[model samples]
Target: MDIFEDKVILVTGANRGIGRALVKALLNHGVRKIYATCRDLNTMPSLDDDRITVLSLDITNDEQITTVAVLAQDTEILINNAGVINAGNILEGDLEGMDNDMSVNYFGTIKMMRAFAPILKKNNPSKIINIVSIAAYSPLPSIAGYAASKAALFSATQSVRIELAKEGIAVYAINPGAIDTDMNKGSDWDMPDPESTAVKILEYVADGKFDIVPDEMGQGMYNAWREDPAKLSKIFSDLYYGEISE
Candidate 1:
């Protein structure tokens, strides 16, 4: 099914970064409506169109998640794109940083999925796309907390996918390697453009791909996992530690 054609989609964290690009791509695909939610709707780049609805939403807040879930019950596509990155190791990092990362990346995603599961069930032939990170598959030592949170989300996505399959609803996990966004401004590695990543992701979703790894790096990680899981972990660890032994 061409999921974006005349469908209603709700995208979280749509004010900027990849989320905003996703909204624009969906609009180009001729989606019927897009509820773009962010912490500050006013900051959202202007998309002068009647089809787009700007909403103020913080996914970490339970009340806000519930409210938006109710308001956008007719949605056929739910994109959980909201997340935060805490730059520190799990053991040595501030406890608050770990909590914040989990709150937005893992728990926030779970909360949103839980709140919208019923609506998705009611609206059959729906899809829920979770924007997980490459960190989910391979953890980095520096960003252990962030990676752990995404790993949790990745596991949750699998469980939900199996449980929702019978209801004709598909759950997708989108793992894109280092996209050029504000989230990774300080990183030295080359990253793809957010707009391009958004386009590829939407295309994959429309084609009903379950695990959409959009970039070459992501594909390489998947290949490594299939060939040797331990080797892949070592490669990631080496890269994180600047070992230059890939």
Candidate 2:
């Protein structure tokens, strides 16, 4: 339905990385207004566009989310792009880090979705795009906790998609592979730049794709997941344990 052009969109974690790239892409796509939010307004890059409004937001904070929902009542698209990855394994890692992963990545995103669902309904013909990860399909041993959180979000996306169907709020889950962002700075994966990844994401969103695997690596993982999840899991495990090399 050409959701981008002239649409009122709200993007979380817009200070940098994918969220920042998405804001730039949305500007190029001719969106009417964009509510770009991040945990710290000071860190937000200069986006000198009349159509954009910068706001402070930490998705984990209920009060901040409520304020944003109230302020951006006209939003037609809510992009849950805020997330964190603590470098830790499920078994020997700090339990607190795992908890933090679930808190912001899973719980935080869910809260934002719930808060904005009503606003989206009022706007009608709206969309909610959750920036999930291919890790949702198979656990990466290094950041197993983050992978688990994404997995939870992926499952929630499926459930909410069905729930929001009758209400005309199209819910989409974007499963991106490693992208060139600070979040993946420690990784050696040949990741695509965030700008290209963001462009691909919106293209799929406008195309009405429910579950979007946005990059080549993520697409391969998605294909393997569809074919056989257990096999994919083993491959990830082997890679982590140095049984295979990319």
List clashing residue pairs in candidate 1.
none
Q: What is the lDDT of candidate 1?
A: 0.88
Cα lDDT tens digits, model 1, 157-188, are 99999999999789999988888899989777
Error of 1 at 112 (Å): 0.7
What is the overall TM-score of model 1 with all chains considered together? Answer: 0.94
lDDT of 2 at 121: 96
CA lDDT scores, all candidates in order? 0.88, 0.92
Where does model 2 exceed 4 Å of error?
243-246
Residue pairs of candidate 2 with colliding backbone atoms? none
lDDT of 2 by residue, 1-246 (tens): 366888999999999999999999999988999999999899999999999999899999999999999999999999999999987787798889999999999999999999999999999899999999999989988888999999999999999999999998999999998899999886777899999999999888878788898899888888888999987898798878883364
lDDT of 2: 0.92
